[model samples]
Every structure is written in structure tokens, then in C-alpha cells.
Target: MKLLLSFFLIFPLLLSSQSFEKGEKLFVEGKFNQAQLVLENYLKSNPNHLKTLEYLGDIAGQNKAWDKSISYYKKLENLKPTEANYYFKYGGALAMKSLEVNKIKALGMIGEVRSSFEKAIALNPKHIEARWALIELNLQLPAIVGGSESKAIKYSSELRELSPVDGYLSRGHIEEHFNRNTEAEVQYKRAILIGGSKVCYQTLADFYKNKMKQPDKANKVWEEYKNKNNKGIK
Candidate 1:
């Protein structure tokens, strides 16, 4: 009788461990549908499983099931709201939802995306992607909808401070689009000086040749780019 009780107690544990392992493997392989089914079944048996909730969120996100993903992530957040990655993923899922929906209705989702990203940033100030996304969203949004150049610049500056080397290009983008030619030129040059990029060189060439009508400078930049990339490549 004692032996039977021991086997019964161990059976559920063994089954749960196997199920979790298989579900994780499926999740990693991008088999989200199967993973979701397996995870949902596991959750039925283990309602408060934190890891199960986290993985369910991931699977939902992968499948682009934003509402389901949010539901799972919220459960995880309720359990532990301090986790930065959870907030980031949640915010990212919201952003993806905003993109997937039609444009007219998409703006409605922006508020949720903005709020989620803000919460993520508040929880982890160093989250670069969240900062950049917020900046991009603000820049693209209409002025009537609370977008402002000053806010974009603020976030851009924060991004630069956090990641100086790659941030120069973002500054260039804002300047170029807003018609701040001199500032844009300076930023593009700074980006090239810090770490050479083919795209940066091409951008500078385009700015000089077309926008500024400086063919000599453009030709020089293009030549440098070509020489660096085309050397001994047949």
C-alpha cells in the first residue's frame, strides 16, 4: 500500500517534467501551435505554473495572438511585475498588434503600445529597443495626437547617451527628415567616423549629391565606400 502511494505521488511529477520538456522543445523549434496545445494542457493540470505562463506568452507572441499573449504576460506580471524582460516582451507584443491591425484602427492600439512601453522603460531605463520604439512612434504620430519634435529629440538623446556608437545614425534620421541639413550632415559624418557602415556612406553620398548639390564630396564618399568594400572581390 505504501509502495503504491509512492508511485502515484511520483507519476504526476514525472509526467509534468516530461510534458514541460517536450513543450519547451517544440517552442524552441517554432512549433508554436503544438507548443500552445501542450502548454495549455499542462496549465490545466498546473494552473499557477510560472514557467508555463511565460512560455505560453512566448508561444502566443510567436503566433501573433496578441490578446492571448497579453493575457499570459499579464498573469506573469501579476505574479512578478519587476521583471524587465516581461514588460519589454509585452510592450513589443502590443506594438506588433498595432502593426497587424488596419491603419485606421491601428491608431487606437498606439495608446496601449505607448503605455506598455512607458511601463517597460520605467521598470528598466536602459532598455534601448523600448526607447527607440517610443521615439519612432512619437516621431511618426500626428501632432494632434500628442506627437512632438521635442519629445522625439528627448528620446533620441537618451538613446545616444545609452549607445553612442550606433545612436549617431538615429540622430541623422531625425535631422534629415525634419530638414535640419547641417545637423544631419554632422551626425552622418560622426557615424562614419565612429564606425564605418556602407549604408552610412551611401546616406552621406545621397545627401551631398542630391540634397546639398555637392558632387565632389559625394563622389569622394562613394569612392571611399567602394574601395573599402570592393577590394580584391573580383
Candidate 2:
């Protein structure tokens, strides 16, 4: 009787999570419009559901509805202020919005994006993606706008301590940004040899195409990626 009663008590929660699961699956499959519809409808009833808000935020970001993405993520931040990923998403959306506007408008956002990314790192010292964002921002912006290769390398070191894949990937990007193609290729290839992430492979592939002028190498990487992910073959 106790077991049966416990099952009944947990069933509703399971059903709720299943809906969230479906929404997440749709989001992952790039059905952002459908995911937005489902998640938005779900939020109509569960107005403060964090995971649903996350999905809505992701869908909005994917669609380039930057303001809406910021809105959803802000609501989530209000609900749980310390989640590193929330701040990362908020900062990323803010950066995109900044890019869409004029320099004057973007100027105000640059500091905001930097601060939010920093806050994410403060909240989770090992948040690799947040660290990567900071590194990129620091490297991309000019000296007058607070660009600092020194700061970026600091973050890169911290990321390397946390994740080898992202560490080398970040290093490759940094090298590429400064036109250090030889070093960039070496770092990208190193990241690829680690081999858990598709992004690393694509980064190496893009380097071959864009920097080395090697489409054949790029195609080979793409084929390798497809082969690893495809399941229809023997």
C-alpha cells in the first residue's frame, strides 16, 4: 500500500517532466519554432518553471529574438540568481543584440556582456563556456574598448585546467584571431585529437578551409563527423 501510494504521488511530477522532456528534445532537434510554441504554452500554466523558461530562452536566442531571449533568461535569473549558465546565456544574447545595433549602442552593452560573463565565472569557477566567452570578448574588442590578450590568456589557463577540449579550442581561436595561423592550426588539431566534441572537429575543418585553403581536408573532417554521428552503417 505504501509503495502504491508513493507511485501515485510521484506520477504527476513524472508527467510534468515528460512534457519538459518533449520540449527539450524538440529544441535540440532545431525545431525552435515548434519548441517555442510548446514551451510557451507550457509556461502559460507553469509560469515560473525554470527548465521551461530555459527552453523558451534558448528558442528565442536561436531565432535571433534577442530581447525575448534576454527577457526569459532575466526571469530565470530572478528566480535563481546564481546559476552560471543563466548569466552566460544572458550575456551571449546581450552580445548579439549589441552587434545588431550601432557602435554607440554597442558600447554600453560591451561592459554589460563582460560583467555578466564574469559573474557566471564567479558563480562557477569551472564554467568553461563562460570562460571562453570572456576570452573571446577580451580578445575581440579593441584596447580602447577593454580588449586584453593578457586577460584572455588568464581565462584560457583557467579553462584549460577545467577542460582540455575547450582550453585548446579557445587557444586555437585566440591564435586565429591574431592571424597566427600556424599556431592556430596546431592548437585546433590538438583539440581534435582529444575528440569528444563535434565543434573541435569543425574548428579544425574550418581552419583548413579558411586559412590553409584546403577544401579537401575540410570535407574529410565533415565526413568523419558524419561517420561518427551516423548510425545507419554497419
Candidate 3:
């Protein structure tokens, strides 16, 4: 009778563990809908599960349900105050929500969004995405409000110190925004030479096609990328 009671006690815990693993696997496979069902069920039993909350937050974000995403991430922030990424995600959701709202509301949200990203950086100096968010945020906001090319450059400088590729790409983006096409092209080329990643190649190609209005140059860039990859396959 004691043995039967122990099995009954342990079985539910084992089942919950399996359910959690299955939910994580579904999330990784990009089956967000299925993952949500599994994770939501798991969360009912494990209310304080951090990873489950994060996955649910990510799924909500993927669905563009910004309010739901923000709620989950806020809970995460409250539960795990020390984690830099929770702050970042909370800030990102706020930023995206700002876009859907009116300008006045967005202006109101700017402080919180900036502070969240700032908090992430304060917690983890090496947090790349938080720095990138700041760079874009600074660039996108109008000068009348708070935008500053100098501030964007400051983040770009930090990115350069951490990752040269991101630094060059971001600098190129800033230069392109300012219509300094030659300088932007130089930065993009340097990024290509240094990073040689798909993003680097695509950024340059899109710049050529759209910004520079040189389709032939874009085609040539793609050809070069294809040739390089083909050689690696050989």
C-alpha cells in the first residue's frame, strides 16, 4: 500500500516533466501554436516556470499580440529581476506597441522603453541586442523629440568594440540614413570583407539595388556570395 502511494505521488511529477520537455521541443521546432498549447498546459501545473513564461512571451510576440507579450515579460522581469534579457524583451514589446498606438502615446512610452534597454545594458555590458535597440531607437526618433546622431554613433562605437561586424553595419546604416552614400558603401564593403555572413552580403546587395539604384551591382554581389559558398561546398 505504501509502494502504491509513492508511485501515485511520483507519476504526476514525471508526467509534468515530460510535458515541459515536449513543449520546449515544439517551441524549438517553430510550431508556436502547438507549443503554446503544450506550454500553457504545463504552466497550469508549474505556475512559476521561467522558461515556460519566456516561451509563451516569445509566442505572443511572434503572433504580434504585443499586450500579451508585455504581460508575460513583465511577470518574468518581476520574477527574475537579475536577468538582463527579460528587461530587453519588455522594452522591445513596449517599443513595438508604441508603433501601433498614436504619436502622443508613443512619446509617453519612450522613457520606459529607453530605461528598459538602459537597464539591460547596466546589468550586462556585453548585451549586443540591447545596444542595437538603442542605436535604432536613437536613429528613428526625431531630433525635435530626442533623436541624436551623436548618440547613435556612441552605441555604434560600443558595438565596434564588442563586435566589429555590427559596428560597421550599423555605421553604414547611419551614413545611409544621412544620404552619405559613399561613406555608407565603404562601411558596407568593410563589413562584407570582415564578417562575410549572409546578413552582410544581403545588406550590401539591398543597398546597391534600392539605395544606390544599381541592380547590376546587386546581382554581382549575390553572384560573389554564391561563388564563395559554392567553393566551400566543394
Candidate 4:
């Protein structure tokens, strides 16, 4: 009788652990629907499971179910506000939802994204991806709705300082859009010097030819790019 009681006592724990494990594995395998079902079922009983909430948020974000993702992430934030990743992802989902639906909605999402990113930054100032995303988001907004060329330049410069190779190309876009032609040229050239890309070369060529009215220079750059990439066959 005692042994049977002991087994009964331990069985629920074992079952709960197994459910979490299986749900986690399904999540890792990208079986989000299965994972979500398992996780949701688990949460019905174990409502305070932090990891389950995190995984659900991840699944929802991956599926682009922004509202669901935000709900799960909010639960996570309430549980552990210090964890920067949750905030970053929650903000990202909101930003994506804005883009997927309406700009007005997207504008609201941008505020959430900024707040989350800022919180993440405060928690870990060296968070490179968060910084990059912030810069990208700032650049994407219009001036009338809190977008500022100065802010873009500032964040872009900060990003460049962190990793010049990754940030130069992005900085070039900010410069280009702000009509800072000379700065843009310097940035594009820096990107090329630090192992840029064919696309970068093409962009620079177009800029020189059309915007700067320097066809000869553009042709020279294009010829160099074509020779390097369009080799052997065509």
C-alpha cells in the first residue's frame, strides 16, 4: 500500500517533467503547433511555468502570431523583468506586427520596440543585435512620427563603433537618405575595403552614375564588379 502511494505521489512529477521535455524538444525542432498545444495544455495545470511561457512566446513569434507572442512575452516579463531577451523579442514582435498590418499600428509598435530595446540596453549595453535593431527601427520611422536624421546618425555611429564591418553598410544608407553624399561615399568605400559585397559595389556605381553625375567613374566600378562576379560562363 505504501509503495503504491509512493508511486502515485511521484507519477505526477514525472509526467509533468516528461511533458515539459517533450514540448521543449518539439519547440527546438520547429514543430510549433505541436509545441504550442503541449505547452498550452501544460500551462493549464502549471500556470506559472516560466520556461513554458518563454517557449510559447518564441513559437508565436516564429509563426508571426504577434498578438499571441506579445501576450506570452508579457507574462514572461512580469515573471522576470530583468531578463533582456524577453523584452527585445516582445518588442520585435510588436514591430513586425506594425509592418505586417498598418503603419499606424506599426507606429505604436515602434514605441514598444524602442522601450523594450532601451530596457535591454540598460540591462546589457553591449547587446549588439538589440542596438542594430534599434538603429534600423529608428531609420525606418518618418520624421513627423519621431524619426530623426540626427538620431539615426547617432545610433548608426554607435553601431559602427561596436563593429565597423557589420555597421558601415547600414551607416551608408543613413547617409544616403540624409543627402550626406560625401559621408555616404566614405561609408560605402569603407564597406568595400572591409570585404563589402557586389550589391554594395552596384549601389555605389548607381549613386555615382545617377546621383553624382560621374558616369565614367561608375562604369569603371561596374566593370570591376562584373569582371569579379560574372566570370567563366556568362
Each candidate's clash count: 0, 0, 0, 1
Specify the highest-TM-score model's number: 3
lDDT of 2 at 140: 82
Worst 10 residues of 1 by lDDT: 225-234
lDDT for residue 31 in candidate 3, whole number 0-100: 99
What TM-score, computed on C-alpha atoms, does each candidate reach? 0.71, 0.80, 0.97, 0.73
lDDT of 2 by residue, 1-234 (tens): 999999999997787777778888898898888778878877877899998999898888888999999999989889999898999999999999999999999998899899999999899887888888989899889989899988998888787788887888888888888899989988888887785467888888988998889999999988887887785431
Higher-scoring candidate on TM-score, 2 or 4 = 2
Give the TM-score comparing model 3 with the true structure, all chains together: 0.97
Q: lDDT by residue for model 4 over 112-217, one digit each (tens)?
A: 7889988887887766777777777777777787777677677777777777755787788788777889998898888777755776787788879877899998
How well does model 1 score by local distance difference test? 0.83
Task: State residue 227's C-alpha deviation in candidate 3, in Å.
Answer: 1.7
Where model 3 places Cα greater than 4 Å from the true spot, the runs are none
- lDDT (10s digit) by residue, model 3, range 1-234: 999999999999999999999999999999999999999999998988999999999999999999999999999999999999999999999999999999999999999999999999999999999999999999999988788899999999999999999999999999998999999999999999999988999999999999999999999999999999989921
Candidate 1 on 1-234: residue-level lDDT in tens? 999999999999999989988988898898888998888998998887888899999888877899889888878778888876677777778777777779878888778778877888898898888877777778888898767778878887888888874478778878877889999999999988776778779888999998889999999998888887787421
lDDT of predicted model 3? 0.95
Name the better of 2 and 3 by TM-score: 3
Top-scoring candidate (lDDT): 3
Candidate 2: which stretches are off by over 4 Å?
1-25, 196-198, 216-234
The whole-model lDDT of each prediction reads 0.83, 0.87, 0.95, 0.82
lDDT score, candidate 4, position 87:
81
TM-score of 1: 0.71
